[model samples]
Target: MYTVSQDCTFTKLRSDSTLRVLFSGSLRLKCKNACCQRWYFTFNGAECTGPLPIESIIYLDQGSPELNSTINIHRTSSVEGLCEGVKSGLVDVAVWVGTCADYPRGDASTGWNSVSRIIIEELPK
Candidate 1:
């Protein structure tokens, strides 16, 4: 069993299904500063295959939020639009993880030095 959420409360995801979904999202931390990274998700079923590049490490920069400040996965290619609607109080799911990031470290033990995982199922249109 897995717990999922959006910009709000926690919800559960169904684990009995044959299809499985997984993903991650976060903003680049520039110069040890706090940053807010927003990631949109959706279902990219078994048909959704690719050599998708993973942004494992994001570089942070001051006043750089204006530089392509959004992580977007097309609605036509996956179920992102619908899932986003669900996040805004539309549908439901068994497992979901959304909006995560590593903030700048302030105490050397906390903040931007961490990693977050964002997972969501791929649904068809």
Candidate 2:
């Protein structure tokens, strides 16, 4: 499963007999100016559920406004961990935080933005 937001793609990967899901994603933020900001984030199936979020790491890239960059958050959290967390029922929700610093260097009016409380269910192991 996947959803598109702000030019960001979030994909859920799974297999039979597995309760874990690998969330692979890429986000792009374009400003009216010539600069660009891109971000990549990933989550384990376990972290995609419940009322509280499972501890996860997010890697971001704010490169040239006109160019595309890739950030692989999965590399920091291996697929194995994702599976374990889901199997243990230790994941609940995922949260994303965005600040004006994430946008263009000079554009400060955007203020703070966030993508929080993303509800995700754990598959039956």
lDDT of 1 by residue, 8-116 (tens): 2234233222223343333332233443333333232112223231222232333335573433212211122222222222223222322235543211111123444
TM-score to true structure, per model: 0.19, 0.25
In candidate 2, what are the lDDT values of residues 1-125, reduced to their tens digit?
12222122233344332333333333333334433322212344223343233332232344344565332222222111233233242333233323333444312111124332233444544
Q: Which stretches of candidate 1 lie over 4 Å from their true place?
A: 1-13, 18-26, 32-55, 59-119, 122-125
The number of the candidate with the highest lDDT is 2
Q: Which 10-residue window of candidate 2 scores lowest in summed lDDT?
A: 72-81
Candidate 2 at 83: error in angstroms?
Answer: 7.3
